[model samples]
Target: MSAAQIATGEIAVGQLDLEYVVAARLTLVAHAHARGARLTVNGHVAVNDAAIRVGRVHGITRDRRGFHVHAVAMINVIEMAPERAVLDAGNTILGNTIQSNGQSGVAVCCAGVTNNLVRQNSISGNGAAGIDLVGSNGVYGVTANDPCDTDTGGNDLQNFPVLNYAFDVGGGVIVNGSLNSHANTSYRLEFFASDVCSGSGYGQGKTFLGSANVTTDGSCNANFQTLLNSPVASGQFVTATATDPNNNTSEFSACAPVIAFRLLSIKRQENDVHLMWTTLAGKTNIVQRAFSPGGSFADIGPMIILGGTGQITATYIDIGGATATNYYYRMRLGP
Candidate 1:
């Protein structure tokens, strides 16, 4: 059956396999089986802007995507099983916004629903998880005895954040990273630093800076900061990984190089103030000076280069500073 628009109150089908090809905003009170009826929803706006008391149940498959399921101000938006029945393998639930349901947004309670992709959708503001893998009965291989076969990856989980990119090394060699995941879920974030960007020792020969267990806030984002046991010179490569409470670990994110300069010491010599700092060899830096700690700073002189290989300690003398007056100094890696 196909339609440009369709609206109904309660739909109960008997023991027959049916396919519905809908192309417009379709509203329904419930989609269920009276005597083993199998249903498939197809077309655009398949079920949009409706108050579905019991969304869909018992062997119902939503194959045609781009469907809008919103304003559901009720219980489950899409429930997989009422009794025990395995959903079809390779069946997909894609690009649908399942939100504002009183219970879970989308629940896959049946087994045998393998190789399915639930990606690029917004699922949030529900009583439970955005997507819950439940039930143990049926031929899906995920039963009460063994429920670990469910794979819920590759989805842009709203309110459930995943690590995006590692950027910015704050507080002198300490690595600061960010992530997106479910709110209040415990996550173990591990950081690794490498000297080489690419080639032989590329992702290899990495030093474990450490790991932190961070819980996401209501916004489903986290800013984790961890100090490295050993300092990493400027231009060193850094990357991170994350593990959820279920011990499901994600692959390492793209590598980001650390760009930081350490100010070592400052000495007053007559009218000139001598400043010394450490930086990676072959790097160029600029020294700036301010009258007070929080005051605006100005560049003292031309760019200085720390030539050759390996780490290097360089010095810059501020010869124009006033005598016996306080002067603050800092160095930043040149762009």
Candidate 2:
């Protein structure tokens, strides 16, 4: 637990004890680091109300008590009673999901990250906005992007919306947005839900630049259902949902099969990494590029349509360019 100089690092709960869970109660943090530092919270930690605060430079340059100058919210949270998981920001973050932390899921009071990607995370049920993204005069602004919705989670009787920020650009990638904010730059949201009223299902939504899009690829009647149906004075909200054609049915076959991923095999082959997996179904299956070694979850190059579903395989070439650090990558499955 020391802060010297972070080049490339990995911190996981699976590697550490449950001490962070206890530290979360006091004013102390579970863990925090900076300077090109890389962190991974792989579905293992149980640190509720875990606040992650990065150093900021406000006051100087009108950064507001040095709180503005710069702040990154790759998956940082703010706006909770005890400020559970209060975070500053990371240089380039990937593979992070924030859920029901204190009040605001991922409270981003005033933050943003350039050249970074946020994927498959839930920013839900805080007192305010699920994933708060805003910047003041002295604070840096957040330029967002949407990966586009791949799943319309309502077709199956088992799928329903849980924590979402999906918007009108595609279908359920961005959710619960503000009209009077952030120069109208579209943000992408990858959301999921536990199960439908009957079975278990999870769906994702997306929103890009100007337009909003939502899709419910699951079978839950009320899953992926927008609490605030309309955008908050934003230009327009476009939604596409798939439900049972009849009043009561469990035919997910007719239902749009959503793009869901389960890590199967991750291997390093020569200079490149070979990523293989299977999908329930996909409409637009794309491969994204990101930084780090054999590691990219962010969208870099133009998306490549890999075509249809079920046990698909794709390879990303490093071409020896990715040497010094870790590169990450993930498949973008949608319908």
Candidate 3:
């Protein structure tokens, strides 16, 4: 059945004993289903592009295998018991846009619901989480329900974390991005740096800079800040990935080029001047000096290589400069 806007008090689309069915592009508003009357099925079934709102009970529930919900919009619902989008394990919920629901946007509320892949969907503005794995005494715990759980070897989730560097006082690199998944859950963010940018081989020799755990805000947004050990040069590539608490990690985001440094400090020493900086690994820095501040600076030393799996602090020393003449120094990354 397809392409119908259902406005009745209750409508049953599929039977419990039916097999091989498809329901698509149906819109239901402020509706309900009779008790025990749901879109039940036994074999393969698909529900796509359906808009369901203000559902008094379960909306498009399933109890059997081969059920899939894609591109469906479910909003302002009270509950998604037995699973809002799927019940049986291995079912798929892909590209469905859900928001502002009274309960969870996607849920696994019953036993035997495992290995469901919930991917690439916009879920937010809900009363509860964008996704939920509710466990009860009637069933086993909600383990391995989210396909993004790496411990169970589920499907890989994909996320991109944005990085911003601040060079001012008390500054650090700020990483911020949004992931489309269950809200209020902690995910690990792994940062990597590469010497090259924009190629399949670019990140091949990438170095792991650091990692931090961040819990998604109510809106599924993640933000973190950390000081780097070395100075990241401009044009170097950087990328990040998200790993759920279960240790399942999403694919790395598209590599972005490093544009600036988080911190650079210059200090005058008794005989030699000291230059210190902090940045990610895998970046190369060139230090230069001039007789006067803002004058033409020439390369004074060899390129400094930052090597490690985390933030790095690098220092350079300039010796035998006329203390009374006032020498100037600056650092820049190699191309």
Candidate 4:
């Protein structure tokens, strides 16, 4: 359908497959005037046209929710700025290919744009971020990860996952990272692979690898170790996003290359236990000690907090284990 408006009660809840070319805009007018509208735009193809847009521009009071744009191809938008291949909010944009557009491939604008889940999409070669969040002040760009995630803007300025290491493990890729945000919260992390990291070092989610769910600790910290079934080649980079329980998606995290797995070394220094390890630079490492081989390990501190720049050897001295006859020491990566 080139230009169609979904009015109230015309189509309550279903899928709208647009195989034909869309010369104009297919707007969901149901949300602009009414509320409780649920629809999905599936398998649509739009080229050299205005493409699809959801929700109205300047009416936040109107309730527009539950729209899904899935498995669609939107490319080469002929429209000028302020019009993109897909402009939406309070919806889900998943598994679509949106590229070479006038503005961002998909943009969520205005003040009240929230709970819009934009993930697992091949969005690149666009004017702005693969998914750009335009704020109430009319500012549109990539927002950096804030400490504690206290700030709020587009998508509540959700904090993206900081990837520490991603290594190709023959059949799959092992990704390790952490998210520091609201305490005692659950987040859905999505991983992606790309040939090159974006210039901003944020994201350009090219290939969706997989996803994992994690909940942060009381300290607003959550560590994750996910094995993506996708086989990423050496030198390729992996990026990820964090979506809170609120369904607000963040910008892409900094890319981490898929390299070899990290190695660790352990030794006994008289009565002290000496441990050393090395991994990707900028990784946070902690030393954990266990009484028995299979016992629960607890973090040992006072001299073992490690984080650095170059690929240097990280050492931890554990004198507390001197008295223990049987002590197992190992280093853990990430928070």
Give me the candidate number with maximum lDDT. 4
The models' CA-based lDDT, in order, is 0.46, 0.30, 0.46, 0.64
Candidate 4 accuracy as lDDT: 0.64
Winner on lDDT between 2 and 4 is 4
- Model 1 scores a C-alpha lDDT of 0.46
CA deviation > 4 Å runs, candidate 4: 1-86, 262-335
lDDT of 3 by residue, 160-279 (tens): 344543221132233334444456788766666656533332121145556677787666665666554544555566666565654333434555555444336777778777888865
After superposing all C-alphas onto the true structure, candidate 3 shows an RMSD in angstroms of 14.4
**Who is ahead in TM-score, 2 or 3?**
3
Query: Candidate 4: worst 10 consecutive residues by lDDT?
Result: 58-67
- Sort order, lDDT high to low: 4, 3, 1, 2
Report the C-alpha lDDT of model 1 over 56-83, residue by residue, as the tens digit. Answer: 3233334322122222123223333122
At residue 70, candidate 2 shows an lDDT of 27
Score every model by TM-score. 0.35, 0.25, 0.34, 0.59
TM-score head-to-head 1 vs 4, winner? 4
Q: How far is 194's C-alpha from truth in model 4 (Å)?
A: 0.5
